[model samples]
Target: MSESKALCTDTELFAAALFQLQVSVWERTADDIPVRVEDGGTIERITPVSVKINGIYYVRSECEFRVDRSGIKS
Candidate 1:
């Protein structure tokens, strides 16, 4: 009998982490968008930034919103 082991590098681990993070961000974004729209906020863009340390990387999500003038009351 023989056992095979797979090795993961830092880059591979970071890539998997990034993918998981992106999925989480997208799920949260899906839930947030409707609420923002209901509150009269316009979505400008969603940006993701990756920060690396010691060869490992993580992602940060930025959601930009614009308020609708018509939805504002004086």
Candidate 2:
């Protein structure tokens, strides 16, 4: 059996929505490589609870972001 936990409370979700908050996601590679910005943008919507599927729990959220073409590798 998997332990269930709430991703976020309803109050927190309301506050985030009310403030129209933003979030930044970072990625780290090897030990020598520094962390880099992967994806970031405004928080459009979020699910307060985690959804279970195939014995796995997932928390989903939506955001508006722009892709940096320069960061793309050939």
Candidate 3:
């Protein structure tokens, strides 16, 4: 039988599979935008681009694929 586990860690889950999924995102400016490092800076106008997962809770418009295997055990 195969065993399964709920990916409790976002970091681990992203590293394993979520990172590979290219999610199309558009920039929508809002005055109430919260401060976050992944925002890439002020979203002054509507923009669209392909983004990739760069870290546990971070994604970068420019970066390489970094897969995490911590969730998998041998």
Reference-based lDDT, each prediction: 0.29, 0.37, 0.32
For residue 25, model 1's alpha carbon misses the true position, in angstroms, by 23
Error in Å for residue 35 of model 2: 8.7
User: Over the stretch 1-74, how does candidate 2's per-residue lDDT look in tens digits?
Assistant: 32212214455444444554433333345664534243334445545443222233334432112223332233
Q: Residue 12 CA error for candidate 1 (Å)?
A: 0.3
For model 1, the stretches where C-alpha displacement exceeds 4 angstroms are 1-7, 21-74
**Which candidate number maximizes lDDT?**
2
Compared with the true structure, model 1 gives a TM-score of: 0.20
How well is each residue in 1-74 modelled by candidate 3, as lDDT tens digits?
A: 33233323445335445334222222224664423234222212221332333433223333222222343455
lDDT of 3: 0.32
**Residue 26 lDDT in model 2?**
32
Query: What is candidate 1's lDDT per residue for 33-65, written digit by digit as tens?
Result: 522212221222222454332233334333222
* TM-score of candidate 2 to 2 decimals: 0.29
TM-score sort, best first: 2, 3, 1
- C-alpha root-mean-square deviation, each candidate: 19.6, 14.2, 13.1
lDDT of 3 at 6: 31
lDDT of 3 at 53: 34
Estimate candidate 2's alpha-carbon lDDT, on a 0 to 1 scale. 0.37
